[model samples]
Target: MTKKTQPKSGSEIFVPLNMLKKSPHNVRKTGHTAAEIEGLAASIAANGMLQNLVVEPERDGEGRETGHYFVTIGEGRRLAQLLRVKRRQIKKTDLIRCVLDTEHDAHEISLAENVIRLSMHPADEFDAFALLHNEKGMAADDIAARFGVTPAVVKQRLKLAAVSPALMALYREGGMSLEQVMAFTLTNDHARQQEVWQGLGWDKGADAIRRALTEGQVDADDRRARFVGPDAYLAAGGVITRDLFDDENGGYFADPGLLDRLVLSRLEQEAQAVRAEGWAWVMVTPEFDFRATSAMRRVYPSEPELSAKAQRRMEKQEAEYRELETVADNEPMTEAMKARVDRLEAEMEALRGQPVYGPADIAAGGAFVSLGYDGGVRVERGFIRKEDEAPAAQRREREPEPSEGREGSAALPERLVAQLTAQRTAALREAVASRPDIAFIAVVHAFVASTFYFGNRVSCLDVTVRTVYLSGHAAGIDESPQGRACSDRQAELAKLLPAEVEDLWDALLGFTQEQLMRLLAHCAALTFDAVVRPGSTSSPPLKHAEALSQAVSLDMAAHWQPTAANHLGRVTKAAIVEAVREGVSEEAAAQLADLKKPAMAEAAERLLADKGWLPQVLRLTQKASARMLAA
Candidate 1:
């Protein structure tokens, strides 16, 4: 190994012309303008240069230091001095006044000079924050005070600097907003950050930030779910607690599977109560997924366990109700007079059908009769209780008269079918016309296509439909010449056609009239079944582990029962009304149980309803039910 040696006090310094050359410390030009070298020369000709140059020591021609150095700073002044001496205005032998600093001190001086004079660009400000905080170890608050900016502003700039350089370029160009910048700061994931940046188009306004926030929240929640798996969460650390739940009538959930089991077990119990009571069962899980604000869906024909606990209090209430129902049933001279005469009947039933009806029995019976009157006469067990209530002129049991005109004329499935069909046809026609390349033949074909319901499938020429997305990019619209032609033509056609034309085209693309009719038939069966038992997307009695697992994993709206049932109801109705005049099959109608449960069906149904297909929905359910029964 060689021995180390200290640098010489006056070393032979040689700096390349292009490498670490010195320049004047005093700024010769303001802003971005070039220096006025000619003006400096004229000034030097009038008077010898005022300042001496600064430099590192250098060797002589023989390559010896000679205790001399070359100019490193004030180079312009030195050049001016040389020119003055050559013109005989200054003596060549004059010794220059030189001031020198160490290299470290020189660096600090360079930074200080620029800091005092330079006005920073936004990009520069952002970079400066990163350098100060990350490289120079300055505190953010300190930097903020030094820069005369808020801590938030400094923090935001640092965050902005963290964004991919490509995205920051967009921000600097005015294509992105401060709100979006703040939103982008919420995540460190690169792909998600890019996704948000592109999703917010150039024209996105301040309101777009709310949408970004929502998306960010959704992403953050998904990440949380992945990070906090249910089992791992319960394992790390937890405390079991007790609360005064209405005198300790609370429920229990045990082990990792308890939360997963809650919805199905709760629903099964709810269903049993409904069957016993002859009331419809409804289960709603509001938070269904993981929305922070989501609450459990309130079940109606509420679950016995979840409902107010039936303490002695509720038992006493039920006992009172049973007594009232009995009083109404047995003590009536006329049903209207039963309530008024209940005690009198209790007293008189022992006296062999005593006809002493009291005021109370009269009032109670009158109320019962009032509640159950079939037009005028009240019938109980197929007979009128009082001749006075139904005048002798109308005492005979009246058969439901045949409808004079149309049955439920205002709300008939057939009328709804007509309206929807017309609407769909108009939408299809408009769609075709709006596209420049869409010939009249295409429009007619589309309208004709829409007249048939496609449900989830359609065929265009030979383009067999698998999925139809309303909001999606069109194929063949890239940067190539062919793509450009197709896009420009499509745009021109859109400009030429009526605005509704695109909607009509989309309608055509979605389904044919024939498909709609079949779908309507399916809807009728599902809705009727739902009305009777309200089975979810999955078949009723959803007990299998797979089904239960799916329900829990899915969003609440994605709960198989209600969401599937709801979609079947809506789509079926739309199909039926649209194809009502097209005439659906009365034979061999299909049950709509084939659709996947715990899927996107809820979102689709909501979208369809928003587009106005409620009437068609009713008709489809009826027709499909009628067909199913016939089959």
Candidate 2:
């Protein structure tokens, strides 16, 4: 029978480095590279092996003790020591202190030592690094070198450590995730951090926290900021907050009031430059809406003559361009020909720079200079304010009074004049209804006169187009597709008409029947009123407008749809649900009914999109007969 050997208890002992062999049953499957081993060797050489290697005494089949030991733990340290011995830094007979055991399972001990050793938590590591920075007076680069990390990584860790103490406590207590903790580092306001943390529930995520923190602040990427530039804003003593953990495009400006002031100051400076050009007045703003200059009269700028030198240069470039074109048409195209052609075109463009306005016209007109959407300066010249226009009575005194008409309109009293105009309007309507061609011409003339002459006496027709201003605001009213289409068409037609009012009749005679019909439709569209007046129902006018829309087959869905920015965000939760229920399916509305107002609005916007739905104000009436009855 085999006899059992007595187990030996663990004890600290000094073993020769050459006698310690790495165990095959080591838990670690990968070993360090040559460079890493070198680094460790240098560390061990300087620190004298701070940790002890765990080893087991080698045994024979007869249960007898051997002089050699098998390393169960610190296999990496063994390799590093071997490297030092090969470099002749340590002798082969040098002794390494180790824990010796004779009975313990080497595999079990190795596994426990590797798998159970806990790494320091990232939060604790961040705090430690911050301490090294603040207490030791070490810079980021120095800390990074000591810790074997990049300077940027050290900076990021320090930023995380700079978060509010309350939030850091929450993180340490396992109440907040690492991402949530990182988001709180965007701002240095301790109260705000606590408020956001207390206000948010589990459903709100890091993005929500970031948005809440950045509320009322402008993004650095905004056009206004881009126009004024960060340099200028910083020069004006503006403070900007940064997000070190997340890539939010340079973060946001903390002081929006300062940003606004800087923008205004820049705009005012630009306005001052424009004011020196002899204008009657110069208006400046960061942005101007469509309604800003809607009621103002616009004057046209006259083209300026070119200088003698510029004219000669332009003529020479033109001649060169023609010669290149002739050569290209006759011979095979070459790079030299292309180059010459491009040069001539560039020269011509340089000669055709912005036109210079005359002093006389500049004195009589004004301009609007503002920051454009693309961060460039936009200048709109030759706008005459209403108060600056010449009085009409002053010029009329030089002309003779018109003779009395068949109704003797001039001699009539004010009330009688109104009565006579009422009768004449009825007669005119009947006459226009009888002749479609004349009606088309009359509407076109009236519209053209109003557009070009600013409602002056440019048309023979006496019909006046009615205007209704809504008391309540509607989203995208001025920027709707229909409005933009009409504006574009008007601009196109304006380019074709004569500058003088007296030549309008001759220009009208030149239009084809199709052109006249298009012009008439546009003019007719301008006369329709769908505004809801204050303290009064707009049912009659709206009903009439619906009829006109239906006759023209207006597609409101093509023009507009509900969006969070335009519609849903502006209304209450109940209104949003109702809109979804009417426009989309009731099931969709029910699904969104339980959400908060902002969340419900966002969901409704998504659900209603591409559904071909419109609000009541935008929808056209069914037919002309239905609309006429309502009217």
Candidate 3:
């Protein structure tokens, strides 16, 4: 009887290609085809093999033999290497380097070798992971440790492997991430997946999806928003005046840092409206504030004009029916019925396409600023920059002739100009004087469109004001209206009032730590889970171990809130529990309290003032969580 033993003498040895055997334990499949093999061969020719192959000593019938080796691992790899050497006409003896060990424990060596090498590409790794998990039945943590990766990464990659090959290829090519792939996987419909995937590929598709994600989803009544698309409005830092719009059933503001949640809230509200009564999508932009075309409100044979058209149409239909009745004697009644249905459908289609008097058309128009949704609906209460400026040629054509005594060829009516100028001044004055509690105040210049056809069709009126603090001293700036408005607004508003111009500017910079906490209190309907170090039993609800990787993602400790969080979950859950306890699914309960809603909206509006809400959003995670969460 012979016993297997490690070769102390011939550890460094060579194995001939023919004698070496492939390992049964090896599972990674070679994706390389003939051309790839040749290219790899060429690379090896220029640079010799960099990695050593593991082998086992050959045995005889008695189970005892010389210490020379036979390959137990890297069989395909060795074959490729040998093919290259043979092509170069290199001697077999020249390939002198390989490590040999006993055959008795060959399986363990093969497993150890493969794990140590970790040479597979992502696709290969996917397969390897599948083998390790599905075939070998290893635990996720064990697999993670074996591969030096987080368990989440392993799960995510495995998740990616399950995606449709087309979508997986997009991920492999860096078009999407594991989370995105995971999201895509939730939609079971192959056609829907394809639709969404292709839609994402379009130049505007991603923007649209992003808008939907950020705004929550549009519903019937809310769909017809008073702004260009929600994406654009939110981008512009839409300060939703939720408080002022209430009758009893509706009206509430979205919390700062909760645009997506707010959108969802709004959608649910609109959906309730639809259930109560039918509603349609209304996209309001600075240019147009209602659907350009709506079927519900017909324009063709306008409602006012429909009765006469209906009578005439009925007469035509009756005549056609009579003719069909005559033909029915020769043909099937089904044919006549089919023909009638087709004719009616065509008429309906034509009528549906015609324009109607939308909310925008019915609403009064002026220089008042307004919010528009879907690039067509405007929420006019104040000034709204027009979506479409009159083309230069059109504007020039519309210009009035110059006054006889004016130096310029054309002059504005002094009366009209003076009136507008005075109106702007008064607005500015009102804005400035309203703040008395604060120490200082200022009015920056305001920009307004003038009927003036001259250079720079805009006029600016800038003013600065200040008040003493506890000491009879004051401070304010007038560099630009922006700077001036900010300094003065802060001076007047104090903490109780909504952020003045300056507070809005700061909020745009990002939610301060305190502000994020305040937002969590205000927007309590969303849910999120919290994760912490396994051993950290005493950690603060909001704080985490500084050394752990989780804390690294959340760098600003004081201002720690979830960044890039897209859904409501535990972190949200914790926030709701800690701040507000209304059920996440209950929109009405989640709606800000009547007294608190205005203050929250004011804070949010100020937060959105200058830069809009997007910059503030960028600071938050796409996934909401405490400091302990990580993707």
Candidate 4:
């Protein structure tokens, strides 16, 4: 006798809609929402069921066929079809395709269909979306409608698909993360994207990748872009690349050159208007470094008297502001009231524009017109460049007459005066050295002058204060404890110091002896150095810095502790291991030997923290004794 063969698990069969029943063993506990069912129903009506339902044969207790099927999977599709039938869009007796299976348990079939199936990777989905839109000629809206997603999502997925094929391949191979791959889409240059990927090697993160991709591009939210406005940029034929996936402030302007040109042109127009005011010259630039203006003399703008009407308005505003303050003190202030107060203050300020320069001063001085950080035009007037100064005034400043009632007063050369001042300076130094308290005050004064009154001759003391810019990059230099301590000390001194330079001496005399010493120590501390200049083969100054640190018994460990951001991340694997060994233990260093650079760096940072290990540059040198000359 021949035996009958059973059907495969996925064998297709047609079943009437009325004959199907929802299975109680369905894994998905939640019922479909009306909107979801409607969407599914619409999709089915448009393209028919894309997937066959999984149904098992219903059997009676005697193991006889009941002529009904239980849906172990695809219950959502069943509900959708039922809704369609209820809406009369399809007949209740219509046949639906289904997979016939009864050998497996109902629960097993439901779980396998819902839980065991893996969703498509996002990269593959992106590529598939692109393929449908590009090769199949489907509009974004049509694709979105078919997939039950918004058009914006479809467009974003298409954008992701536009990334370099090489980068996408890396993403597929698990070599890069989704975010890191998304950063490459900022630019469409495949060669550049690959170059950046290789340059980053294994160290770069998503933010770094985005920064590299937008190197020459300006953020659309930048002050210059805001000032120029997007409409103007696009009208000028400048391109902008947007990131739809992430919130990057409307994306980046791809043509920074054009943006800069627009900024300069606008500034030039502003300068031309200022030049018409009878100034000697009007200079325009996007950025103006105050350091560059040190050599020039600043002529203060004379405050112009307000008109009678304006004075009345100002007085009224001031009275209102006072009233608001009193009310705020007694009761809570509303946002609208605060805004009104701010507007009043702004109007008062506008009425008091720049001081009016006299005709003569205007003729001798020029103006600098630039864009402020807020995107508004900033005009600095009445700055007299040295070359533009009158010849008579220049002569008077250059020439000095001999004073009477002094030895050799008839004619003393400039060199002799310099020599005399040099001697005086040396004597002052010796006096200050003997009195450490005064020496401390002097150092503190110099520090304050450099930190707060930078590029200005504002010190009452005869000491010369130099303002030094680091000019070389150092990791975590700003966040170091030493930096924070100095900043705090500066803030305290700034509060104590008199606003006017003439009152500085009196202010210094008021400080207690202990306060004076602490200020002096801080000031002297600023003089210490371990800076390495760029392109320098040897740092002779660093040797002296070590000596100075030793002289003061500098405890750098108290102010600094190594971290990944400041030290470990900046060095090689070998260097990190050595740092860890010196700062922690040999065993700790050994534990980090096999880690990747980033992980090793992090481990080293944590191990070295609070271990009191100083880099060679930060170590103090031994104190040297002075030798007496033999007679």
Candidate 5:
């Protein structure tokens, strides 16, 4: 119009770097974060700029060419280049490729570019990562550097891409989820993955998918696998399936048979060493149950006595620890003093539980060898099988007078022993009621006994301290830490208890004061019938149980945690969301609200894993129930 031919819309042009200004018409109001700028800079540095900046000519107020441009869509890229220029890596006059637009509204053009963009689907990312590694021969570290992610993340994505292609198709089609895809990457067995996929109908979750794929496999962390170290098992031709997504996963041994053989081989070797100690006989089993020896008798080895010097040291340490504890309660002590107290306590623990049985007991009794939770060999001594029992007259001399109305002294039937223990438990309760401190200690002892060991009755006490066997209602309860502890203690005690009720009196007299207190606690613990009934949860006994829980500072979190199998999966989707909201945060709950129940449960378990959360009933305070109900 003014003797100058106007440039056509959608024209291509080259703009100088220093001449490009951030467009005032940009739709994005929030400025890019420093991390975003740094990442963008890295991407450009590694591989030169890939996207074109949308820009228009900047006109002076006099309507004259200003030799400048306004960058519309790629302001982030413009900044990244400026950063390169500041580092003297590029000149300010470097030409940038840009699309010049004039016809469309500037703001509308920017908004359209920002709004129409779609993020690359995670499935595409997985495949892309795999292609770079497989076709281009790029390592995980190289790919991660280009993408600004951890090498572990790149490996995880590469593994994800290796999942059954059919399953990946399903993931792309929205028929499956990212989590399900990740779970399928646990193994590269395409046939098994497809088999599991077909068998699973709907509402499938990562945990269920993983379980199906790993069926018949033992976790590398399993006691059996641990007993036979992973390297040893692998050397025996065992295969392992590992999860790339789980950094902490120890992996699953695909051949459990091989692992079992190795465990047995190792245990037998340990048994050989134990047999050299001169036992009547040594038996090796994968697991030894004290319950299996209820028909047997256990003879004691004369208790070991501490040497004079050791006894003096022990007493001095105990006194010092008590004094430090006293001062700690009244006022804070110096760090050095507190540390000294800790050292003394540790020394006492090291000295306190030395093996009570002696060489003579080993000769008279056989030992059972098995694996402990940590995969260490456990040798349980002092069991007298019926065939190994002493001569009748000698055994009779070992046992003294029978309780009133009880006849047999040696090898009385189990039913009679039970009756005698019941009677003695009643007498012990009456005795404990008059001695409140002993009663409280007995109760505490009952719980501690779960962590420690010893439980049986030659009528000293058949401490069948059953506290509401929740195993039926809560599957895998027996496998829980607290549950296993209690079960193991009960079995060990059964092996040690005298088979004859007539020997009960002499056995009780030999029991240490601590041992007697344990028996008393066992008796008291058995009487606790405070299990919540269908409609009687608020009964008087439960109140007393609550009081006792508070007194003992019973923190259930240490004993149990919510797992997909134990708590979350059994509850409703709404309940899972609420638990996440309460145990974590509202935002976290919102993230899970859209997930299906099974997936939500697994997600909730991960979220609450280390949070140390518990339900109202598990809380020590009785008021917790009221507060939860009100909420």
Candidate 6:
């Protein structure tokens, strides 16, 4: 008898491929996809099978060896090797590495292999990719090929590796999401990344984090940035910040101050060209200001009648077109005939286009050079300064040309002004909503001014202001929070009044002063219209609304938060980014600078919520409410 040693258990074996069989006791039931098998085959062909299949011996009822093994853990991998043999990449008899388990149950082995693994953490994978690039000196494309990923994915992973190490640890500990991690990649400055991360709330979202990090930079599509094209700005030594996570948002100009200088330089150069056209003076501005330009005088270029040759060509083309018309009514025109009509129309139009400007009349006028809507140089020629306006002697001779908008008024950004003012009105309405003191003051003021002043038309105090129908221009105005509160208050007050008009005076006499004042305040609040009608000014009511707003310490943030449906979505991208900078951080706004209008507005709404951000029209010169409340 030999000395009995415990037979080696769970031994590794090089099993012949044909002897491997699918195990009925294996845990996984879902069949492998064809593509999964193909990818596995490709991975195996390149890497030579990195893992072993777990197996156990196959036996009959008498516990006799059946000359085969049942695969437990890696049926998928076994299938891939079979595919390789079918493709002639390997032979069916090729030996495959496997673990032969005799003591452990087959299903338990399969479950352990399948369930005991965790996918590599994103930070780890990112670092591994970075190691390939930084240590191994591998390019993105080469690393991508080795890892079965696209070059862009490799590049992104590498960039994520460059994020602040502290942030990576947070990600590892499961404190931050992959989206939030991607946001940190907008800037390469680790200190900034750490600072922004530390300052934000734990739940701060990706867009908010991105905006805060990018606030100091100008967006690539900013008017000034675009005016100085990215290539030129870079050539001029401007820096740019790129985010690999969101290529759609584009890059940001890290040097906004530098871009502005470049923009003004370009605008001044454009002004010099305008000056050469013999204008008295040329004014350069980054953009037109309505208040600054509204009082100026504008002159027109003298339109000369067409020359004799042009008139003759137009007449001839008209005759030829009539001839073609008669033939076309009978039959379709040949290509040559159509070409003749086109050529005749072109020649005639070219002749008609020759309306020469008499430069002599425009010499007295100067140009206002500024940036246009899409960032091109805009030159408005023949705009005379107020002092340079035509003398009354000359003005009486020529007919005054009709101009767009009121004479001497600058063009307005009508939609933006109205939208902002409407939001302000909503906030103001809420502020005055509960104040009975303001209503009492207005009523007393109106009575004294109207009763004492003999010949006065009305007091500058518009105490009896008219109610505005807001739904026409303000979307969802009727359903606004402020609007609903006012409606509820009004309805409640209405129920207290006598049903018949004859009994109203008796009922009011019976009520407490507080109850009467509540009714008065509700009535006054209904007429509180602070909206600036689009394309027109509402000065008195608006001015009065601001004064009343201070009395209540109106904190609009309590009543309003920016949403795509409300404020940001209605404004320009520039406005949206500016709000982000004011409410969040400059870096955050910078991240949004490159986004199209819709995305920028939505991002702004997220960043500005509960941040005390208010539009220009809604902002007060001072937080009178806060100061008084402190008192």
Estimated TM-score per prediction? 0.22, 0.61, 0.25, 0.51, 0.55, 0.48
Model 3: lDDT of residue 271? 39
Identify the superior model by lDDT, candidate 2 or candidate 6.
2
| Candidate number with the higher lDDT (2 or 4) | 4
Compose the digit string of candidate 2's lDDT tens values, residues 443-474.
67877677655646666577786433221266
In candidate 6, stretches whose alpha carbon ends up further than 4 angstroms from where it belongs are 1-46, 51-118, 135-141, 269-280, 290-296, 302-304, 312-349, 354-356, 386-631
TM-score of model 3 vs. true structure? 0.25
Superposition TM-score, candidate 5 onto the true structure? 0.55
Q: Which wins on lDDT, candidate 1 or candidate 3?
A: 3
Could you give candidate 1's per-residue lDDT for residues 1-631 as a string of tens digits? 9886635533434333222223434333452212334335454554444544455555569977545544555556555555556667666556566654445344445445446665655766787789989999988787765544567667777876786676677778887665655555545555766765555433244334333434312221232222233344345442111111111221111222333243234334434543343222222221111121111111011112322343444455456656767876776445655554565445333333322322222222211111111112111111112322223223234467678545555466887867877898788768856874444344344433332222212334332222122112322113224333432443332222221222445543455555434433332322222222234464453334334334334222221222234344345533432322222222212221232222223323333332333332133334344554565
Model 2: lDDT of residue 9: 58
How does candidate 2 score on lDDT?
A: 0.73
Model 3 poorest 10 in a row by lDDT: 445-454
Clashes of 5: 1
The candidate with the higher lDDT, 2 or 5, is 5
> Cα lDDT for residue 164, model 4?
90
Ranking by lDDT: 4, 5, 2, 6, 3, 1
lDDT for model 6: 0.72
**Each prediction's whole-model lDDT (CA):** 0.40, 0.73, 0.41, 0.74, 0.74, 0.72
On a 0 to 100 scale, what is the lDDT of residue 399 in model 1? 62
Identify the runs in model 4 with alpha carbons over 4 angstroms from their true place: 1-24, 29-42, 54-72, 78-106, 118-131, 156-232, 241-254, 266-282, 297-631
Give candidate 5's root-mean-square deviation (CA, Å).
11.0
Worst 10 residues of 1 by lDDT: 366-375
